[model samples]
Target: MPDLLETVIENRWMVQPNHANNLDTAHGGNVMKWMDEAGAMSAMHFTGETCVTAHMDEVNFKQPIPVGDIALVKSYVYRAGEHSVRVRTRVFRENPGKTETELTTESYMIFVAIDEDRNTTSVPELTVGSERGERLREEALSDAP
Candidate 1:
């Protein structure tokens, strides 16, 4: 069994001019790519196998992260089926100097584990082994689409 909390991963990407859209904010595609990478990492870490994205739930851009801001992406495995892992990923706009952060985008991603032969493989069950893990799972469930 894999503990859900152990699958958590976080990454920070500086929103640069190259990542900006015409609005001078992070592009939606770039944000989604970051979220996907984070989510895939969580899934792969949990399953100890190569994981590829199978599906993505509807994503929402609640706020735009302007250039010079940090896009903080966090991901964790909340649930697992026989061969698929469900990951919850969220991006926040962060101002490091002021220590401020706000939600920018969120979505659930599903990934399927694969083996060296490129075949789907069974994954270990996910378990919530601590209070914090339980709380995080609950939060993801509540925010699910």
Candidate 2:
């Protein structure tokens, strides 16, 4: 089994003008798109097969990403079942020097692996093979303020 930390994926996207809404901030839809993509990447890393989103537990937008800012999205598999993997994703804004990071959004997504025929397939048990993996899993389960 691969360690969740090793399987963690990070995706960065520039908040482009076209991706913004009338408010000049990144559109909520664009943010959700990036989150889903990042989460799917993490799920595929853990399952080693194509995975589809079964559910999105919650998505809270606590802050807005501006056009000149960069959105850094990180995702990792925190828990896995027979055919499902629960992934936690966090999005942050990156600005040089300032080094400020705000948890703009977070989501807990469930994905199920699928075979070539598009049938759900069982995935291997997840193991926190490293201290970092264990820490990430613990963080994922922690209550959000």
Candidate 3:
């Protein structure tokens, strides 16, 4: 069993000029890419096998991450089926100097565990290791809108 909390991952990407759009903010594709990477990492952590995106819930872009901002991407495994793991991923626009942050994107991703032969494999069951883990799981599920 893999604890949900143990699969959590957080990553930050600086919005470089090349990654910006004509609006001088991070491109939507870039944000999605970051989210996918974070989500995939969480899935891999939970499954202990190569995980690939099987499906993704609709993404809602709430805000833009402007140039010079940090895209803070966080992901965690909330639940898992026999062969697929569901991960919640979110990106926030962060101003490190001022310590301000705002939600930019939220999405749920599903990844299927695969073996070297590209065959689907069974993933570890999601286990609740602590009270905090259970609370976080519930919070994420309820907060997802």
Ranked by TM-score from best down, the candidates are 1, 3, 2
lDDT of each: 0.96, 0.88, 0.92
Cα distance off (Å), candidate 3, residue 32: 0.4
Q: What range of 10 consecutive residues in model 2 has the weakest lDDT sum?
A: 94-103
- Estimated TM-score per prediction? 0.98, 0.94, 0.95
lDDT of 3 at 145: 54
- Per-residue accuracy of model 3 over 1-102 as CA lDDT, tens digit each: 889889989999999999999999999999999999999999999898999999989999999998998999999999889999889999988997878789
Worst 10 residues of 3 by lDDT: 136-145
Candidate 2 per-residue C-alpha lDDT over 45-132 given as tens digits, one digit per residue, 9 for 90 to 100:
9899999999987788999998888898999998889999999988998774577777798889999999999999999888887788
Best by TM-score: 1
Worst 10 residues of 1 by lDDT: 95-104
* Runs off by more than 4 Å, candidate 1: none
lDDT (Cα) of model 1 = 0.96
